[model samples]
Each structure stands twice: as C-alpha cells, then as structure tokens.
Target: MEAHTDIQTTQKGFRCTLCDVNLPNEPTVDAHVKGRKHQNLFRLRETRKRQVQNSVFVSGIKPNTLSTQLIEYFEQFGPVQDVIMDKEKGSYAIVEFEEQASTAAALHRTEHVMNGLKLRIKPRESKEFKVVLKKKQDGKNSQVNLDALSQELCRAASVNEQMLRVVESFQLNENERNGRELLVKLLQEVFMEFLPDCEIVPFGSTVNTFGVHSCDMDLFLDLEKTRTFQARSKTASEPTGEGQSEDGRSEDSILSDIDLTTATPAEVLELVAAVLRKCVPGVHKVQALPTARLPVVKFSHRNLNLHGDISIKNRLALRNTRFLQLCSELDSRLRPLVFTVRFWAKQKQLAGNPFGGGPLLNNYALTLMVMFFLQNRDPPVLPSVDQLKNMACEEEECVIEGWDCTFPSQPIAVPPSKNTEDLCTLLAAFFSFYATFDFSASVLRDKSFQRECADAEKYCRSLQYQRKSSKGKSWGLVRLFAPSCPTGAGAGGRQGQGEGKERHLELSLPFRLAALPDAVQRRLGTAGERFREQWFAMVRLAVETVFQEVLGCSPAQEEEFEGQMDTSTSSDAVAMDTAKEPEEVGGHDQTEGVAAPSGSSGGVVSPQAGQKRPFASAETSPVSPQEKRQKLCAAEDEEEDEGAEPAPSASWCWLQRHPVWAGRRKVRRDLLKARGVTGGGSAEASQPDGGGVEMELQVTRHITAKEPDPHDLVAFKVGAQVVGGSENTRAVLRFTPLCDQKGHFQDFFHFLEIFLPKTTEAFLGK
Candidate 1:
C-alpha cells in the first residue's frame, strides 16, 4: 500500500488529516480518498497555490475604475483570469493571470495604467496553503472583551452605573450597525434579481434594541409579493408558452425552477441556498436547514465577518422583535437589565449553547423571562403581552399563526411604567423573583438554572453585590458575573485558591425516581415509605463501589450519624477532626453492620442505625462486582416511622493510591475495543442497568494495570446525606481533603464533582 502525506495509519483505522475523518478498512479508505469532498479540497488547495504564484497586486488604481477595465489592461501581458477589487475601499486590487510568466512580465514593467491612471504593480506575496477553519458564530470575541469590560465596570460609581457600563460595552457600535445595514442592503439587491419583489426584513437581536456585538443577523425574507409576481408571470406566459413577464423581465430565472405555491419548505430553502451560493459575492458556507423548526438558509459573509440566517416563514419573529423594541423604549431600565441577566446567565453556564439547539436557554427565552418578572413586580414595571395587545388601536390589531401579536407600534402610544425601581434594584429583583419560580409548569424547567438563580439572589442581598469595593477587589457586578462552580462545590477553602489549603468539594445526586423507567420505579416502590432510606443506602454502596473496586482507593475510618450535623462548619475544622484520629486503612474495628430486615433477597446491610461496613476489596472479597450491584436492587421493605428525623448522614475516609481519574476516557475506549463493542456499547449497555457500571470498572482496571503505582496523593473524607424536600430529593456528598502536600487533591476532587454522581446514578438505576 502506498502512503499519502495527508493519511496516517491508526491502530483501528486510517485517519485522513485533511478531512479530519477516520476510515475503517482498505475499501473505505480508498473510497474516502476518491470522495468528492477530498477531491474538492485538493483542487482548492492547488487553486490557492496557483493564485499566490500567478497574481499581481495592483495599487493606486482610481476608486471608480471598473474590474472590466482592469481586466482589459492586465490582458495586455497575458490572459487575465480574475480581478478581485477591494470592495470596501477600492484603493487596490489583485489581478490574476493565466500563467505565472505573465505575472512576472506584468511585475517587470513596474507601472500599469487603467483608465489613464497609473497603477503600481508588484508580484503577489507568497504564502502557506492552509484550509480556513469554519468560524464559530458564538460571539466568543465579545466574551473575550468582557475581561476588559470588568475592569472598566469596577471603576463605576455604583452597581447601577456598572450595569449601564456593561450595556455600553456590549451593544453594537456605529460602525458595526452600519456594516450590518450594508450587508442587508446587499442581500436585498441580490435576492431581488432572482425573486422579484422579495424583501429582507431584519429582526431578532440585530434590531431588537438589546443587540450585542457579533450577534447573528436574523432576517425574515418576505416572499409573499414575489409569490404573487411569480403567479402573475406564470399566467401571463401560459397562453404563449413564452418565459417573459409583462414588465419584460425574464421569467426563466431561478424562480422558474420551483412553484412557490406548490413547493415544499425544503425545496424552497434549497432554491434560496442555491441563490446565495451562486449569485451572492463573498458569501460562503451556505447551508439549507429545512428540518429546523423554522426552515432557514444559514450563510456567512466573508468580508463582513458576520453569520446570518434567512428565513421565509418567520413573520412572527419580526412582530416579536418589534414588541421587544417597544418594551425597551417604554422603560429605559429594561435594556440594561436584559443585558446584565443575559451576561450573568452566560457566565453561569445556564444559557447560551453556542450551536443553537441544546438544553441551555436562548437569549430570546431569557429576555421573555425578564419581561415576565417585570410584569409580576409589585407596581408592575411592564404590562403583560395580552395587555399590550389590548392597548393597540383597532387599526393596529393583527394576528399571526393563530395567535394575537398586536402591540402598540410606537413607545409614545403606551403609558410609562409606574414602578420607579433603579436598575440595581430591578436587577436584584430579577434574580430573586426567579429563585422560587415554578418552572415545572413552564418550558423552563431546568433545575441547574433554578439553583443558579437562588445563588445569585443571595449574592444580590450581600454588601459585596450592593456596593463597590474599597480594597480594589472585584465587587458588585464584577463578582456577580464571575463564572460559578457547580452547586455545592467550592474551589479549595477560598475562591480561586487551590494549593496549601484544605479543599471542600461537594456533589448532590438528586433522588430521581420519577426519571427512572417504569419497571425500576415499581421495584423501588416495593420499599414503600422507607424508599428514601433504602435509596440512600443504595447510593452509599454505589459510592463505596466506585471508590474501592472501580477507582482503586483504600477505605479508612467510617462513621454514621442518626440525624443532620452542623453543615456550616469551616473546612479547617473538618480537616482537623479527620486528622485528630486517623483510622487504619480497610479497618472494621470501629465499624458495626446491621443486616437487612426479614425478606431481603441479598445480605445487604443498612448504614443508617449507626452501622458501617468496609467496602469489598477487588482481590479479597468473596462476592463479584455484579453480585454487589444486584445487592443494591434487593432493598428491605420497611414501614415508615412518622416521628423519625428526615435526614440521616454517613461519613467515610479514603486514601487514593492511583490517579484513576486521569486518562480514563482513552482507557475506556481501549477496553471497549478489546471487548469488540462499537459506539460505546449496544442497546443493552445504554439501559439504566448495571452495564455502564461494569464498563466503567473495566476502564479503571485497565488504567491501573498499565500505569506504574504512585505514592498516596491525597486522603479525603466524604460525608453523605439525603437532602431536599419531597419535591426535590437529592443525596448530598461533601468531600473534605485532609492531606494534600502534593496538591493533586483539587484535580481529583474536580473530576469527582462530575464523575461520582453519574456513576452512582447508574448503580442506583440498576
């Protein structure tokens, strides 16, 4: 077999570097090498190479000189292939010849003339050939600017002023808005040539008055007039079998390819995509997403560095955009409040999923949430949507898609809000309002978002959030905008300090019986009112299995509490308590075990009655891992004790002897390969059964067997308790790292922050 520079042999397959794809076998590799995408990229690379070699950079050309005149002048030396002018500032252009010799000939002349004006000509600069990576439309540059913005906001006179500064820093500048307007006009002109009378209406963030820099330009392409024109042209030409309209325009244009009245949304979108790709200059990456909720043709303008979506069936979005604009105008406070909340949500990772569709909340949804909060304020900062519809005159009344969208066309038509709360107070109230919102009844039922709102509400009441800092530390809006850690987890003992201190790490595994399959739910229901206690015991066993058998950790001292202990103690105190009396590794001297009651299938013991048991060692335990997992499902049915305390907690110490958290993903892949499993696993592995647990255990074992043994990195104490009321039950685990002279505990703890919950869930689901 011949080797290609772009193709490299991997363990399981051959990888194509140019396309960033893997091919499984010789036949697939051969097919991929001959594929259209691979061939197109190869030709593009060669064309770019030729352009660098055969092009001449022309300067000092007259601004109004046409590309045709430049082409005529350049052809004197040799045939001119292309003339690319600087459209923004027509001071220079690049003229490409048919051959490199012609470029040399033109460069040697030193002077060129076009339309009686002398032009400076030089050989085009040589450059490396590299593929242009697709630009992510996430507005990441705007996020980068936020670091500078925080410094600027820190010097503000008050939190209200800092918020205004945030708006000033993020909103589109004059140049940016002008560029978008020009782009829209350019698009309008291009689409008019093919689909006559079509109008491109800008909507969403671009014109919603709450726009940020680099936001995507959402355009509603109104083709109703064009559809009428098409029908009229078809009728006019039907009698003569000719393709000319009454206005003498050619009816045999791109519109002739499809009947707008009869065409499917996907078909029309494809036509739009074709027009964008073929006719629009500087437009690339044109894609038609017909399957989207609102079918759209997504495109990017190369020169403008902007991404945009063109939708033909989104008239409702235009009305919604106008409503947002009117609301922003009615109350001056709305714009800054929306901007600050959006930024805070972005920082908290509760919103802004870059690729559009995900669990994260979008900007529009977040804006509406703010409006809803305002509408519910004590004095009512904003009117409800239905109320706004009533406020509009009869002449302005309108409906779209079976829903009323009428609103006052101008801000002057509506009365001012009576609520006179300052931006600071409104911002704080926005957080506090949503902290206790009933999201389950609405579409915004994301628990993580609710938790973040509660945290922000607490911060908003603090002095650090209400006032500026005198010690020049981050305070007010700056502190609020800082990226937050996961719910119960904190960074070391203090914020951002990881080394030379005791670290406190916590994770919450909610009782998600409702999220389980019906069969699993039925099995859990068999435990009756004592289900919570049994579930907690199952979680404890899962945690022990993950640390000992799966993660190669040795169990130390273990303690169980009958009721909730003080959770407000400092990390230093927790560390001192663990250090004061260290128990021997894998010791059962101080441990007591209470066997499961009456008819329990397995000999599973309850950790509740101040009873503890050592975790089963991988090499020494009589039971297999699968048996241990089965024991978790065999819970004892017990009657509920009405007078019992709601919370029972357990604490255990573990000494980690390996970096089990590191490189587990690669090892997992290798182990799956060894087992001949593809796509992670088959359908059974995806089930909530014990398949995932066994796979993860195998992954850890593979890593431990391959890597050299290291000295003890850290010893941490984990305390577990079932918290939350009836509606939101969860197992909360607080980790206190007692010994960390090597500083590896923080990394391990951060890994467990995500790992422990997921693995434990798999165990409990089994």
Candidate 2:
C-alpha cells in the first residue's frame, strides 16, 4: 500500500517542469511559477534546449539498454540534458548536451562500444544540415579532436613525428572536401540562374592539398563561357525569346547585361558583391576588393561559418594552384614538410601579414622554397617542373598568360622517386640548411650589389697581402693590416672569426693593448683609461651574446687585473677643457638649430637630398697651406676650450649574433665618395679641396690610433673622421651589458632595432 502511494505521488505531485523543482502543495506551486527565479530558470532551459538541438545521434542501441544508462555514460563528457530513444523504428537515440561543445566533442568518437554492440555516433539530422554544415558527414567528421591531437603532438619525440601530427590535425578530411564540393554546387546553382554559362572553379589552398583548418576558400568565376554563349546568341535568328534558365530564374538578369569582353574587373566584382548581398540566403559580410592583384568579392556563409572569395581574373593563379596540388600528390612527404617549416617561421615572427605591405614572406613563397629544396635534394625527393613538363604528351601540353603550365596530369604518369629520407631527417636538414645560409650572398637586391663590390676589392687585397714569409704573422694579422681586410689567403680565417672580429683582432690582442704608444696615451690622458675599460666590456658582451649564445661555442675567458691604465683628472683647467658640451656642426654659431638626430640609416638630410660640398671655404684660398693649417689647429684648440663636443651623426644598437655591421662603415665612405662628397666634413670646414684641412688630418690620425669597437662608450665631438672616413664627428657609443648573458635581454634589443627608428622618425614628424 505504501509503494502504491509513492507511485501515485510521483505521477500527480505538483512540480515546476522548467526548473525541475518539486512543490508540496498547489499554493506553493503557484507561488514558484510566479517567482523571478522560475522565470530565469525558464530562460536558461530554453537556451540549453537550443544548444542541444544540434545533438549527437547514436544507433545500434541494445534492447536492454535504457535512456537512463545512456545519459549516465555520456554525462562524463559534459552535462547531458536529455536522451530521447525510439526502439520501435530502430534501436537509436539522440543524446543532447547542455553545451554545443559537447556535441562537437561527441562527433569525433565515430564508434562507441556499448553493451557488446558497436554504436555509430553522429550529429542529429536537421533539414538544413545537408545543404549547410554537418558535424559528421559520410562517416568522417568536420571538426578536429584538438585535445587528442595536441596530446599526440606533445608526445612526439622528433620533428618528423610532430610534422606528421600537424599535417593530420590540419589537413582537410574527405568529408570536408565533400562538403566544400556541395557548397560549390549550391553556389553554382545560384550563379547559373544569373550567368547562364559561367563556370566556378576552386583554387588556392582549398584545392592545393596544403589547406589548414578554417583557411579561406578561393573561387574563380570563369566568364569566358558566357562570351561563347553570347556569340551563339548573336549568331542565332531569335535567341530563344529571352527564356528562363535551367534553375527557372529569368533569362534577362542584371548579370546577363554585363559584357565580359569589355567590363572592368572592379565592375564585375561590385556586381558579384551586390548579388551575394541581396540574392544569396546565407551569405553575409559581402565585400569587394577591386584593387587587389586579382579583384575579388569576398563573403561568408552564415550557416557554414565559411569565408570565400570570387575572382574574375585569376587564371594563372589557378594553374599555379593545380601545379602545387600535383606536386603534393606526387609524394606523401611534401605536405607535412611544408606545413612544419611554415609553422616554425610563424613561431619565430619572421613571416606574417606585414603592415603597410612590408617585405614579409607569405606561405606560398615558403612552400615554393620547400619544393625547390626537395627537387634539388640528393637522389631527388621530387622531380622538377621541367622534368614534369617533359613527361607531358602533345595534347597534355598547356600554356596560360604566355607561360608554360604543362605538367603530368596524373601522379602515375611520372616514375616514383628513389629518395628514402624520413620526415624527421628532412625536417632537421631543412633547419640546418637555412640557419647557416648566407641569404645576403644569394638573395636581396642590396646584398647582390655589395657582394660584387666586395669581391673585386677582396681579390686586389689578397694579391697585395700574399705572404712574404710563412713563419711570419698568420693571415689573420695580415688581413687586419689591410684597410678593409679585402684578401683571399686570409679569407678562410676571416670567415671563421667573422668580419667584425677581423676588424678588432689586432686591437683586441693583449700584446697590442699593453704596447699602446706613450704619445697616444698622453693625448687621451684620463679618458683613455675609462675608454679601455669600456672597450673591454663591449668586447665581452659581444662575445657572450654572439658566440656563446648564438654559435654555441665555449666563451673566451678573461682574467681580472688592476693595471696602470687608470688616469684621474683633478685639475680644473684640464676638466674645463675636456668636459663634453653640445656643439653645432657647420659653425659654432648661435644660428644653428638643435643638432641633427642620428640613426642607423641616415642623418637629418636624406641621401636623396641634393647636397653641395659642406666645406665651401676649401675652394677659395686666402692663406698658404701651412698658415691655413696653423689657423685650423688654433680654432680647434679654442673650440676645445669652449667645451664643444662632436655632434654624433647616427647611433645604433645591433643584436645580430653575426658581424653584419662590420664592413658597413667602408661601404658608407665609398658610397659618399662615389657621389663626389666627403662623408664627415661640417658645412663650414673639411671642404672637398682643403678647408678645415687640419681638423681632417687630426681625425685621420686619431681614427688610426687603434682599431675601435663602435659599441664602446666614447663621446663624439666636432673633429676629423674617428672610425670611418668622411665624418667630421666622433662616435661616443656606450655599451652597457645586462647581467643576463644567455639572451633574456636580447629580445628587447631586437625589438628596439625593429621599431625604435620608426618611432623616432614618427616623433620627429618625418
């Protein structure tokens, strides 16, 4: 009797269906229904119901299995809201989750073994699912199981394994391809009503077989067929009285009025954009890029969440896309290797969609490089385009936009490659090949010109430095003696030590530092000691940052010592003379504005600005050479007393682990001289002929005092060329090393090099 009463209570007791709240009496139920809490719960239930509308459908449920058991088992993934079963038609169930993510996750588990039966799991069917997007289509799913794939990739031991995992995670599955095809067909049907005979072709990554998840779909609208149809219409007597198209749309359409032969690409794109916005059901965000290399109308499908573009002029791109697809099909290894290299470059911030269209390499360019490397591999992993072209039959020969586009249509037409390198080995080799690559020698416009000039000078210097005695100084020292170290016998050593070290090798020697001339030491006085200490510190930092960190070489160690290099200046007269002060360049007059800002690139005046010789006094001789030299010396002494310091031309903080800036000064001097102008003269002195001649001579002598590191903290003043010729100013670069020797601070330096100059220019309103 108690059991019967419990059953009756469960059947008829008052309960809030929306919140699943039980009420003991009718009055309590009425109050709960009218409460704000119940209203909020009702809204939440509606949202959950909408989310599970895209639930996972399960089939092959056993007769003994109940809905409660199904819910309990699946709820481990997420909260299961409902489990609707129908055993009469078939043992099937729709398992709904409170979240859409759960549905997406469940779709990845294609087969689930439950109660000795293998059940097929898929997305619940909807009327629009086939026409739009299906979580699972034809047994393969649309979304990747990222958690599982990420775990697998993390566990991968080699680059080869990681690359393969990346490919598996990112590649388009057969079902996705089929869905894209269906979408293309649906679009074709809609376009046919307007274009009558136009053809829509898929291109780019979508069909190139290197597609990643969510990559944009590229489509080409071929209007050539429309021209052929129009020609037929003109030749016919009545043209079929403007009948309806196959899809039953009007034959007289806005697109029909367009003459493809004469219509501008922009006009056609705008027309497409208008059609997509007004006529297409799911298309949104319709935009036209008329000024693109190939004008296109871009749009996104609401239901599918897929972005696409339609182009009127991209036939060459289509051919290239086909070629890439063929190359990918020829070998299974190509796709994985390309994907891995692209991923690495992106991780390194070396490539991306650059701002203002800077020189950042795109994915296509990287892919080509990979393909080229493979083709040039030992035993040849893939055949070259020329080889593929030669394999084509007469009918298979093709040309587009006056360039050969011929290649074997099928993979079986070409013989299989004999190269057997594994993915891991290939990936490792790819990095090793690029890390040591001298891109300046092989690519970049400026590098090519620099190389040509360097080679000529190098050959001449090598002949000059040919050894007089084998037991004498090594070629390393011989090259150092040369002005630019342009030589061959010492080329190997210079390459090993780097150009910067080649410049500093003699000066940095302990013997050379100890044997500093007395006259030079006296001239520098107290500043000389401070200068030496700073120079040593700069060299240490360079070695730590460049060699130890970048090259993975053992760091050269130095012993600490207190030497006689220290010289303290206590005399007020000497302090007053040597103290640094801001000085103007042309004339030490009050008329000059703030001194020109310095940078790695150029000064206040650009290289393109038409400039006359700054030393105009050289052309007119008022005094003899000796008397003029005396006057110039006297003027320099007076300026020294006035506490004038040389205005720095430019300053830079370089972060390359190599010595790229080693030979830059030489290039700058040569470049200035080539334009028939001295590189370092002030507007008032150091003229082309003989003006400010004394200052120029002193500068030459000082620059040759000892080879110097540009990074050393030294103050620049109005003087002759100190380091590089043709500069009237001295460089006072200060090098302060941070304690983090292993490159914790190197990133900040790199970031500065990239952005600091641009920011400086922006601040100056350049």
Candidate 3:
C-alpha cells in the first residue's frame, strides 16, 4: 500500500491521521507510526533542509553536518540572522533579516547552491508587513487633523443646523457626486491595475430616487467581462457593446466591451484606492478589508466621504445580491421600512449605528428576520425576490450608463405613508409571529400561519381603506417576500454547518424573541422587554444592536456568508469554505466578548471602530519591523547606557480589543441622570429609572469534546427554556467561535447586557 498520509501513535489507541484505520489493539500499527524506520527518515529529511535556510523544500541531506557549515556558506553576501529549521518535515523554513532591503537583496542573491543544496529565498507573507507600512506612513499622515474636523462637526451639530445640512447633502445627494465623475475615472484607472479592464458601477442613493446628503457611496466594483451585462436595447442608432444583429444592425450593449481576468479582487480594490488618493487632493483614508462590509475601502474627497465595496461574485451570488437589492428597490415600502426602523432605533438610543455597532445589531439581519417572519405568514406577506424580478416594471432594467444617461420613465404608483402607527402594527405582527411560528418543519407545509393571514386578509377586505395598490393586493401589516430557491441554484447541494439548505435559516416557533430561559432566559427576556417599554426609542436601539450582534450587519461578509459560512479556525483558515474561524486580522479579536452598545459611541461606523475619528490616522501597517541585533559587547553597552520602557503586555491589548455595549434601558438613568436618581417617563425603562430586573443568566457548558480540537470554531450550544409559557417553549442555537480563546463569557454578557434592558422595556412599555 502507499505510505499513510496521517498515521500517528498517541498515548491512546492507534491513531491514523490520514487513512482512517483504527488499529486499537494492534501494537504493530502503533509501532508502525513511531519506530526507527520513520524516525531515521524524518531526521534525514530535516538534516537536508537545515543545510540551506529559506528553502521551500530541502530533503535527503547528510545528518552529520553542523549549523556552522550552513552559516559559513550563506555568509558570503553579508552577516546572516536567525534560521528556522523544521526537524521533522525537512521541507522548508523561514529566515529573517535585520533590514528588509537587505532581505530583499539576499532573496535575489541566493537562489540555489547553498551548503551543497539549491535554496529558495523569498519574502515571507506575514503580519510583519503591517509594521513597515505603519511606521513609514505614520509621520506623513500626522498633518491631517481628524480631531479638529470631528470637533467642528460636533460644534456644528450644537449650533449651526445649516452647516450640518450642507455637510449631509454632500453625503446624501447624487448631485454632490457630479464633480465626482472625474474622481471616479481616476479610481477606475487605478483599479485597472488589478482588474485591468473591469468597470466600476455606482448604485443606490448615489444615483438618486430618494437620496440623503450623508449617504456613503454604494458602488458595485464589477470585475466580470463586458459581455455579461450586454443586452439588446430599443434604439437603432445608439452605440452599444451588444452583439451585431444578423440584419446588419448595431446591437445594444450596457457598457464598452472589455476583458477582465488578469488580477485578483484584493489587487483590484487596493489599486483603485491608491490611485484615487494620489489623484484626488481631498481624498484619503484608504482601508482595504477584503472581509469587511464589502471588500473595498472608505475615504473622503472634497469634504465628501464614501465607502465602496467590491463584488467579484459568481453568477449565483451576483444574482442573489441583485435580486435582494431589487426587492428593496421595487417596493418603496421595503427600503423605507428597514431604513426607518434602523434610523428610529438609532435616534432612540436603543441600538448602535446602522453602519457600525459596538455590540450593535445589523439592519440587514433585522430586515432578514422580518422578511422570514412575513414569508411564513399565510398567503405570504410578499413575494420571493425571484418572483418580484419577474413582476418588476420594465424600466427597472432600463440602463443609461452613457455620459448624462438618466432615467426618463414615468414614476410608478409608490405611496408615501411613513408613520409611527404603521411601524407599531408591523412590530406587533413581528412579535406575534415569533411567538406562534414553527420553523423546524418544511416551510411550504406550515399552513396555519397562512390560514391565519388569510383570515386577517378577509377581515381587512370587509373593512374599508381609502385607496388600492396593484390589484388592490390583500395587504398584511408587515409585508415580506421569501423567494423560493431556484432548482438551478441547487439549494440542495452540499450544506455547510451554519448555512441552511431549504431556505435561509429560520427560527423555530418556540424561539420567543423576548423569551429567555427563566434561569437565564427570563432575566434576558425581561431586560429586553424593559428596554422596549421605555421611550420606544430605547427599543429601537436594541433592535439595531442585537440584529447585528446575533446575525450580521457586514455587507461584504453577509454576501460571503450568503454563499458559505466556514466555521473552522485551524492551520487551514486560508484554505477553503469547509470551515469558518473567528476573525482577528487586526489587533481586534473576535473572541466572544461584550457586545458594544447603540449610541454615538456605539452607532459609529465599524471600519472606524477603535479609531477615534475619521482622517485621524494614516493607512499603514500596525506593527514595526524588528531591528538588527548588535554585537554582544555593543548590545551590552547600549543596554547599560539606557533603561528601556517595558513592552505592553498581551493582556492589555486583549482587553482593549472588546468594548462595552449596553441597551439604553439598561443604564439610561446612570448616563443621563446625576446622583443615580430615577428621572421621569417610564419606570420599566432602564434609562429614566434607577432600577433593573435583578436576574442572572446561567449559561450551561455544551462542549462535545473534552480535549481541544484545532479545527472546530463552535465553543458550545445555548438553549433557552421559557418559564411561564402554556407548553414548555424552548430555544436552542449553535454559537460560532468569534475568537480562538476558550473562556469567552463576554458574548453572553453582551447579549444579555443589551437584550435584558430592551426586553424589560418591551413588556412594561416604560
């Protein structure tokens, strides 16, 4: 048989790492894993590798040679630094140098022929690159004063309303983006460094219908070839990238024909930001987080700041994203519903910012849950995205990408009924559905919800409402569209752990949004209700924060997860979507910790989290590169000459990674009232009131393995049982690892911290 890939002999039974042959009682199998035959082979491979450092693969070397022989051979260019030798693999190791330039020189100078073996030398990809960029850019960027700008905005907020409006208009309106076309061209030139000939398309409020002044530029960086979007148009003389007609007529094309396959997504986004910063004077702050809301950057130009996300999505992901975006667009009811709820929640100080959350809720998450709730209703509140696509006005697809291309179609019948009463009814419906809905069974089989909804519809039909909409559609207070998965989309394909197969994951009926286990759930439920009870504003904050914390608010990550959620944190993190791990690219650790709150501090944009203000810091690496070690005598003299400052401990940085977040109802009185006295408004409200529901959540350990498993990201499963329900109502969910560390009580606390306050306010309506 061929050599076993993963055969290892541990203290327990015979363990075969690769070929799964459990020879529990066979001593031969055990010995086969750890014997002189394997040991000698391992040493021989290791010895050969040690002959030349930084080699990708080194094997079959004489074991008798010492380190001095390897050092002498490489010393020809200059003095060498530390050498890493893999004793067992005998395959490869890394070598560091005092100077990066010197290291670069060495990589070029030494390719092969070191210590009787060809060697491989190249710069190792590591976090060290961050340090070099950080140090060099730090000084130059200091000139841009972010604090002054923040102070100016804050002062403006206090007095000058017009200034804020002007600033807001620049951010929210499409007209502000007029002078930005030239800027966009510059950006395209830079992005082409990676995508070569791909196009950058801007959508959302930036294009107009209902835009605000402060809205971030929502752009879709399309890296696909030009042939993809080319569709026939109505006009004959218009220039198009579309195919030539058989009748010798020019076909319509959405954009110019282009080729785009030479570069990766990362390279594309980086180049665009780099080029924009160089060409645009007011544009700066280029952050490239591929795994963020969208793999792009957020920067400002000419007093206007915008964040752009790149979508190099496959046809399926693209279709899904576009479908969802269209659903929000088709119904003026959809975007406004979500945006209003989000904004209200923020204003009330119940949740964090829509874009940034401390332990904040994501607007998308709440919208999704709402969508699921409405879909499960009888007759379904709205159509799925695919169904909507088929029903959209032809003008929805009307493209006008040429210079000065703008929509000229007649406005359709969309209403303007944004009021608090409608919001309250929708929320009431939301709670009722969760309290009564069952999601474990087949969705199509759940007829009770639809039946009740039908009854409600009949009741509404008998009653009188002013005007009618498309077909006088039987309206549910809260409308939703749960698009059925396409047979072609292959929803039944190999399922991931966190990913749902049939429909996007749905909550079972027993899951009371307000119900927490009496021992644990009651306290949480009460706190959440209490927060809701207070200034209704507080409840809004909780909604935004929790949605993001429990679900997800990240646009880019959401798009990624819409495809697959890999929950594995092992040596293979960069490998594939087989597993997902806790996110910790920056010093910020995703270890389950206290979720941040919703307020000015909490509601701020996330990419700007940990950062105090915008335009404050330059884009650079986080750490500094190591310096060359001096000779022993010189090092001793230097040390003797000056005492050094102690290095910051890991614990300090660890604590700094997570910030405290809370529901407004939890500690409003402490924040707004002096001397810890309860104010007015509502007693159930944690803010105005000095008292809170004194209860503790008892979290049980549900870890399956006693020993550590490197591949698993889930620490445990949390189950909540309602105390007073007629029938025992229970809720259970699997928790993914947000960090590698084991002892993470913070996530639980973050949940309860914001949840309890809001739950309390909800029940009491304080």
In order, candidate lDDTs are 0.71, 0.50, 0.36
TM-score of 2: 0.43
lDDT of 3 by residue, 457-507 (tens): 333333221122335432222121111122111111212233232111112
**Runs in model 3 with CA error above 4 Å?**
1-171, 174-186, 189-196, 203-213, 226-264, 290-294, 311-330, 347-350, 353-358, 369-381, 389-728, 731-748, 751-766
In model 2, the Cα lDDT at residue 695 comes to: 30
lDDT of 1 by residue, 358-391 (tens): 5468888888899889999989999888888878
- Return whichever of 1 and 3 wins on TM-score: 1
TM of each candidate vs. truth: 0.58, 0.43, 0.32
Instruction: Return whichever of 1 and 2 wins on TM-score.
Output: 1
Worst-scoring 10-residue span by lDDT in model 1:
583-592
- Candidate 2 to native Cα RMSD, angstroms: 24.1
| Span of 10 residues, lowest total lDDT, candidate 3 | 628-637
Please estimate how well model 1 matches the true structure, expressed as its whole-model Cα lDDT: 0.71
Q: What local lDDT does model 1 show for residue 345? A: 87
